[model samples]
Target: MSRSIDYGNLMHRAMRGLIQEVLADVADNGLPGNHHFFITFDTTHEDARLADWLRDRYPREMTVVLQHWFDNLVVGDDGFGISLNFGDSPERLFIPYDSILTFVDPSVEFGLRFETQDQESEAEDAEASPPLRARRDEPETEAEADAAGDEDEAQDAEVVQLDKFRK
Candidate 1:
């Protein structure tokens, strides 16, 4: 058998490390400048923790905005913990780094998306699965733009795909 370096997995680990470093900085110094995050993760992941209601509502995936009013940001080697408001109710969530799907910083037009082989196969089987590409389209409505923090309008956002580097 030919053994080769798993560059895709390596890149994924590096990207996740980058997110961890950035989150650690924000936990200590708060979000700098106009930077904020839209983090989407797999709600069904084994280590992912959230309110039962939230899981019911979000089912497979959930996207959380880390802007305005959030508290108790804690970064750890395996994952992070944060408290966010949902309909005036503050709920704490523990999101394992491995569960994350996409991390976006619309302020700087930057984004990262991670896909595992299992997820790719599942996506192919599921018709409603979201597109693999990170969308950089303009927001169609004011409400959407505000609620999503203009993520859809990030025209220059660079979405990194490790597959391109694979042999």
Candidate 2:
């Protein structure tokens, strides 16, 4: 058998498309009850441009929540832009699709992990390739899955910016 097809890459691209679709829908109709997103991306990716302060803080990777306090959320073909509050201050973040590492909607226990071309091609050995986790249809609680690790990590990457929206 020949390994001519790059199904893995195709799958990753399709998943990114799904993300764009979901965000586009949210942009158009608003998030339907209880549904939110936890998006983790590589900060150093060439296409990723974060606030200087944010870049300094999350030098490697960062996760953002799309629940309540984000504005001007625009999802485009190559990347996305959203305004979030940081330390009660508003900041805009632009992340390219290729920079994303993981996207999880703990509300529904749906998650997708990605392996970028740069990342996959960097390793000299195939064993070093990132494992692709199959999506589980089962719905679980945020406390159980904890996709982004702990509340501290979530707080560290506080892209939800709820303070400004809070009274």
Scored by lDDT, the top model is 1
Backbone clash tally for model 1? 0
With candidate 1 superimposed using the best TM-score fit, by how many Å does residue 117's alpha carbon deviate from the native?
Answer: 1.8
Clashing pairs in 2: none
Q: After superposition, how far is residue 68 of candidate 1 from its true place, in Å?
A: 0.4
Instruction: Score every model by TM-score.
Output: 0.74, 0.74
CA RMSD of each candidate after superposition: 7.4, 14.4
Per-residue lDDT of model 1, residues 19-64, tens digit only: 9999999999999989988898999999999999999999999999
lDDT of 2: 0.79
Location of the lowest summed lDDT over 10 successive residues in candidate 1? 131-140
Candidate 2 to native Cα RMSD, angstroms: 14.4
Write the residue-wise lDDT of candidate 2 on 42-94 in tens digits.
Answer: 99999898988899999999988888888998999998999988779989999
Provide the overall lDDT of each model, using Cα atoms, as 2-decimal numbers. Answer: 0.83, 0.79
